[model samples]
Target: MRIELQNTFVELRGEQNPVASAVLDALRSNGATVGAVAPVPDILIVSLPLLPVAGYDPATQLQSAMATGEAMFARGSGRVLFLVSAAAGMPMRRHAEFSVAMAGVLATVRTMAMQLGPKVLVNALGVGAIGEKVVAGDAAMLGHASVKRPGTVAEVADTALFFCDPLNSYTTGQMLSVDGGWSAGYGRNF
Candidate 1:
């Protein structure tokens, strides 16, 4: 099936972050045709980073990604997989801010998926403590993840592939956390 891969916040032409690059490469090498600005396709994979920068805004970034995905869906794209990585499940520096921002994005995606009908599916991959130094530091502050070891690139890539595949028809508006059981242990009442 054809795919439209959107790399939001891509500054360097043809250069991308490791995870994004890996996902694109894996999809292409596995025989999926990749298009940038397209006649649209069967899927759109959005890989955007979550961080606080002076002029770079996460909300706008998310909106742009969502808009592009919506446009693709309007043009007959089947699914959109939003791949977002936050430092230890925190979208921003503050927990509450992160929660609000994440919720907004999720709600928008879910609503769009519903409005667009069964042809369009929206999914998110929430990664936690994936060996990045910033994530590692955050994980330490939150105590160790239940898995202890950081997740690998292969692991994340595999999950992305699963969502991108046709076999994943039943899942949508879902946040599949590759967070190593981190979300479960948070604020556990002992």
Candidate 2:
């Protein structure tokens, strides 16, 4: 699925992330107008990283997504895309906290979609091993994934575009896995 984002105004929540950078680049390359937060954006993309950081609060990501999503105006015309961890579906035994947190995000996506149906679309991208080689527990990300490789930022960007695209009107309150099939009955369920 390819989409033309011409003249679309997009806002990104986690611009510091590599995946966000890739999404930004892709949006620009596809002719979407991307920059700092717009009071009301055509598309709002939130990239939530799975990295475990010291002193990091778990509620921050969820709260940020909710708060930012709430500001979106333009009823009947808006898309919210969240790039979260695949562990939300297939739990990572070692990363219990991450798993639990992302599960909430997925639930929020579903709930919000229901609450804002036919007006705004709310969805999430379940990311896995996207250049996070430093994650010791996920050292063999490629091996763990059914595709036997870590997912690329470009792939994630492409999927993000799909979710943010106007054509994706029917797919809301869903989480699409962009982790080389890790979350799709492939990894950790054997």
Candidate 3:
């Protein structure tokens, strides 16, 4: 059962969303040979939903996404790139709902990775604050990001490429934070 899970939901508050566009371009440029299931391409990209810090829901969404990934893993074939965000690690100003939600999703990924074995590598792409118009209003919160500058679409795409590369066989069940250096600093102001 070869599955190509495409995430079409765009976040209302996201600064930039080149992921889907880049993915489409990748498919077009790479041609139709990209979706092979038998040998299964070296990578499988799973774009999960993005929730805001306020009114959005994360629990149900995360659970559903995790279940989808788990089911894919059960089929057994290629590597899975779980696209999460640095927002998952953001400070909870109003509520800790997002944190709790991502925790559950991360847990599911880890557990599934352990049970699946080496053939199926599960990893996550943690996006840092990117300069997008949607997040312009929240500059204060994003100021703490290590680079202090927003990330580019190319940077994110590059990281995704690295994870999906056949040469990256040794890494698995890991959460790669591409958030400049925000995740490292302690008192903020990196």
Candidate closest to the true structure, highest TM-score = 2
TM per model? 0.73, 0.85, 0.69
lDDT of every predicted structure (CA atoms) = 0.58, 0.72, 0.53
Question: Could you tell me the TM-score of candidate 3?
Answer: 0.69
What order do candidates take by lDDT, descending?
A: 2, 1, 3
Which residues of candidate 3, in runs, are more than 4 Å off? Answer: 1-16, 23-42, 51-76, 89-91, 134-138, 188-190
lDDT of 1 by residue, 160-185 (tens): 77777766778887777776766665
- Worst window of 10 by summed lDDT in candidate 2: 132-141
Q: Which stretches of candidate 2 lie over 4 Å from their true place?
A: 53-61, 71-74, 132-137, 185-190
lDDT of 2: 0.72
> Tens-digit lDDT track for model 2 on 1-190?
4678887888887636777788889888888899864567888887776553333344666677666566663344678888777766677766777677767778888987887767788998887877645321254445677777676788888888888777667998998887776666443532
Q: Tell me the tens digit of each residue's lDDT in model 3 across 1-190.
A: 1122242111111122465345434433433234333333434565544334544454555454445455556665556666665555554343356555555556656765786556577787766554564321134435666676766555666676666555567888777766777667566432
Q: Model 2 misses residue 183 by how many Å?
A: 1.8
lDDT of 3: 0.53
Task: Note the residue pairs that clash in candidate 1.
Answer: none
Worst 10 residues of 3 by lDDT: 7-16
Which scores higher on TM-score, 1 or 3? 1
Per-residue lDDT value at 135 in model 2: 26
